[model samples]
Target: MSATASTQRPRLGVTFWLLAVALVALYAILVPILAALYGVSVPVAFLLGAGMCAAPLLALWYPRSSVAVFTVAAFVLPLTVSPDRDPVWPWPWSVPALILFALFVLTLTMQHGWRLGSLALLLGLMGSLAAPLLLPDAASAGAAGADLIVTASIATVAFVVGVLLAGRIRLGAELTREREHAEFERSRRELVEERTRIARELHDVVAHSMSLIQVQASTARFRAPGLPDEAIAEFDSIAATARSSLTEMRRILGVLRTEDHTAELAPQRGIDDIPALVDSTRRAGAPVDLTHEVEGEISAAVQIAVYRIVQESLSNAVRHAPGSSIGVSVTTAGDDVQVVVRNTPVPPSDPGTPGHGLRGMTERATLLGGEIHADRDGDGWTVSARIPRQPAATEVSATASTSTSTTTTTTTTTTEGSA
Candidate 1:
């Protein structure tokens, strides 16, 4: 009953309201005029007309009000017709009341849906048919039965049509929403498939190559007889480097395979690990000097970025400026950490396509809201970055802290195993 009393609908806007108001004014004038011709009195005729006009407009937002008004109007208006006339609705509700009442039924159906519409339709039929039976002049009135038939038939048709149109409109809106959801799901599936394919390619090609390097470097001493101590140490350093690279490659593959957060197995290298990294390069017979200045604790994310920036720079130096005195300097000032790596410029011997290292460094700095620069400094090439301290993506520290964490750092426990 609460729902039937009134429904809150989206306003059809000013133009629609203006059109509806005009229609109501037209019916308001004509119904009373026609009722007066049927011997209905001045005051009663206008009251009936007002009831018919109000029923339809109220149906738009107030179902119970429309039903009450239309039901009463349908029953009372019929008895007002003169028995001398063709009582088949008199001025015939056929021309006047029939259409106005039908409008009420049609609007009710559209606004509140069919269940309430059916109720209104049923009640309208009962009221319209019952009124003429109570008419004192109904017995002698010609075609009075036909009047009831015509009124019922028109209202029923309006109800049936309203139901069909409402169902079609509702179905159309539902289908549009479902189509949009399906399209989004399809796009997401394609993105996940693309990432999986890239991970598979790296595992098959890059991982296999790094594994071979580790195996060869590990077996070099046994393969060649009477190798010098320095050369053996160099081979051991190469093997360690290969193992470390393979480990890092596995970490990258894990990220590419899926978007989910997975447990990290090993600790990442950072500022403290810089000394060991330089020692390994020195053992490989490349002259290198390192300097550092730091105060207070730094975040794991910044530490990892700093370590990778330095590592990539050292790598570029060894390739483009081999056997040249390379300088690595790292320091912290306030909230920012700065790194500078310089080496003798290549002797016009190394010139070709650029690598992804510089791009990688720039992207890393940008992600952490920082900056990186690579430029030629006199006869030397320099790569530098100024990265602000930021929290890590995960709780895992860049380097192990306690006795228990140290053991996990060396253990291979990731989903993507070593190369």
Candidate 2:
């Protein structure tokens, strides 16, 4: 058994208390008979029986020590308390032996695994075999020997049965663990397969469609003669944006397709790209007013997180609240950047069910050690996020320090030469 399983305390259930009560009752019954057989006072027999019975209770706390205590008691009890005249040598040992055997079996079952149980069985069998040697006279020795043989046979059978049962229990536990591990492996394999299928669909269908859009937008001016210069410039911008989106899509797909994919050659977009995103939204017929007051360099991860949150919020507004003026504000204080996006409410309509867009935004923010809140504002819906900028701030500070040290050295050298 594992160390964790072995060291854990056993629960004291109803059956445990019942067994303890039964043991005390058995001692009560055996004490009177023992006193009568030994011609001893009732109190002395009760004391000896109580001591033997109590030894087993110690197994509840210290299983190995209790087994030893009980085994020793089994041998010593008969020797100390002599039977009455015309004694049957084994009769006095019977009650103590029964208690010892019960405790031995109980300990074996309660403890995990087989090693300890096997040891308990071995000690009990040895104790049973040696019981006849403690007989007080040769005449009684013959009767004790016969009793010993019968008792040892019963104990041997009990030991074999206990070992078999313990082995079965261990086998069951092993099978349960194996089944759970197999289920986990199956689930992980299915997830990876599902992700790969999604990557393939996006690459084949979405990427191909985007590529066509980029190609058509790039060639539109040349194919249609006499196109206005402004129209040509618009087409150029469309092609550039489409190409950038396709590149980003490819990087994402590559990651899904392989575990060891390399980083993309192009840098990821950050908070600085939010203005361009807002401009695109405006071109798409959503009037977006953006206010950005962030004052320090932020990590690329935090930038991406902020950009995605704003993008999702704007997309939701356009889909659900078209013609509504959207307001996006990004501000930074100390090592934290806050982003709030709100849109004026349109006429009440089916808001549609909430879905992955909001959840994805929340998850992205959380991964960056930030938090996002999305709720209904007065006559509008609002989404806000707070992100940490400490990583980028540290890098920027280190760079500034290096530059300052270099300038100081140059100035010091120049001053000394001039002196």
Candidate 3:
């Protein structure tokens, strides 16, 4: 699981094809010459040289086994080859075999690690070196002097070179993995830092203003002379609502409360608070008629979105159409919560452009796997939202959900948008 899985076998590249061709040429050219010099049948010479050529390729799968076969053939061939054949070609070990044996040692060393390769080098040298001793007169190059040295040197060099190259390849691969891991960690750290910065800024600016509002509202009764009981209660409600908003904002930003501040853990306003909202708006000058019909359990996220959308709609209606009767309805249909708010139609007093409040409502509805549609009806502007009862796993679900309301002007722009 640490590495990505490969589904198919890798294809052999051009390097492998070229190596195979070189091995075949060695077989075709050397077999006839070896047969003539070995003083043996063509089949015998072919078989002996074949093991040397095949050993390098087979070393990929069975390194020790190929080494054993190559060693046996190397030992037997020197004894069978005629002593008086030729002095020009290397004695005991032919040139083709010398090349092939070195290749075998290199392949074994790289693929199977240096331990097995060291063992193979020792075994190969043993058979080739002992051939001259066994048939002292058959050493066409003066009794195992130069030929023995040549074979031993070639093998040792191959092993040493193979070890160095293999180590380099392994080091490079390890470095690549380490670099990728470091980059991933750095990106994650940057994301966390950015989120913290955003939260701090919001707390410094927005939290400060809300704190002032709550304090002023809470102390209004003391500042005013002989305030009525109902007026005092309304100011207290405003203070309590402000405090609740501050607590919720802190929770959302994941900011810890200080020693002077206590975590309120207040519940958000939901369906039950709609009547109070209507009453407050009526007191503000806009008369609102509200009806509620909720069924099944609704997620806190969906409830909050519904409440905000309603709150914003009412505020817009009151601001733009004071004394106008606003109709608000909350109901559930199967797996969704439905909200509809309609305000009395009036020729838009301002330019019919979408405002921040309208955008906020659209964003809230869209945040939970929901859609909001705000358009003009014959009588007035209607702002409706359909949000799922259960919250979605991610905001991706919100994007996937359908919505016609991107940013409608709502109550402020009655001529062009919804309320």
- For 267-320, candidate 3 gives per-residue lDDT tens digits of 255665666666655544345677777756776556656777787777556545
lDDT of each: 0.66, 0.62, 0.68
What would the per-residue lDDT of candidate 2 be over residues 1-419, giving only the tens digit for each residue? 44553444454455458768878788877777666665546776666677667755655556667668666656555655554344553543465556556555654554434566566666765765564555555236667666666666665566667667767767877999899999999998767756655664465346545655665576666457789999999999998998799779868876776442111111245676777767656655556777877665666666666776787787677656756788888878788879999988854774644544565566556655678999889889899999876433332312122111001011101010000
Candidate 2's error at 287, in angstroms? 37
Candidate 2 residue runs with Cα over 4 Å from true position? 1-25, 36-62, 83-86, 89-92, 99-103, 106-114, 125-135, 225-234, 258-419
Clash-forming residue pairs, model 3: 410-418
The CA-based lDDT of model 3 is what?
A: 0.68
My TM-score estimates for the predictions, one after another, are: 0.44, 0.50, 0.47
Candidate 1 lDDT by residue in tens digits, 349-371: 67623644565566556656678
lDDT of 2 at 307: 74
lDDT of 1 at 99: 74
Clash count, candidate 3: 1
